[model samples]
Target: MGVSDTNYQIVYRGHHLEYFHPGGWVFFQRPKEAGGGFWLGRTYDFVFMIELPRPVSLREGILYLQQLKYESAS
Candidate 1:
């Protein structure tokens, strides 16, 4: 499958988060000091982050993964 330039926005805690145009299998990297680490107290440190290709639903994510697999097989 080809890539899609779909985007999604998320708002939380009075903050607006924006993500750039994305395709399948999006990932967000959070800082270790900001709670993305393996520590216990800072578990909720990832306050703001966004993923690409925006999963409209669980089924959509599944389909996207399947498409990725198909593309890799080719």
Candidate 2:
């Protein structure tokens, strides 16, 4: 499956969030909203989680991860 079709597991506040596809080669802010935290990860078998001043949207995070997968695949 392509990066766009990959599924992700997102946990927020001890709750499970829906899986979303992060685009390729994109930067994603973290936490969900503003003033939460930031996270970074590769589509491969590794993910780097970071804390941000604000919670970013899930779309961005997912897209960024997908990009990583694409890059590694290349």
lDDT of 1 by residue, 3-74 (tens): 244322222223323443333133233344554311111012343233233323434544555676689999
TM-score of 1: 0.30
Query: What's the CA error at residue 27 for candidate 1, in Å?
Result: 10
C-alpha lDDT score of every prediction, in listed order: 0.34, 0.45
> For model 2, where is the 10-residue window of minimal lDDT?
18-27
> Per-residue error at 73 for model 2, in Å?
0.5
Instruction: Write the residue-wise lDDT of candidate 2 on 1-74 in tens digits.
Output: 12343444544543433343443122233344556543443232234334333345666666666676699999
Number of the predicted model whose TM-score against the real structure is largest: 2
Candidate 2 residue runs with Cα over 4 Å from true position: 1-7, 14-55
Error of 1 at 23 (Å): 16
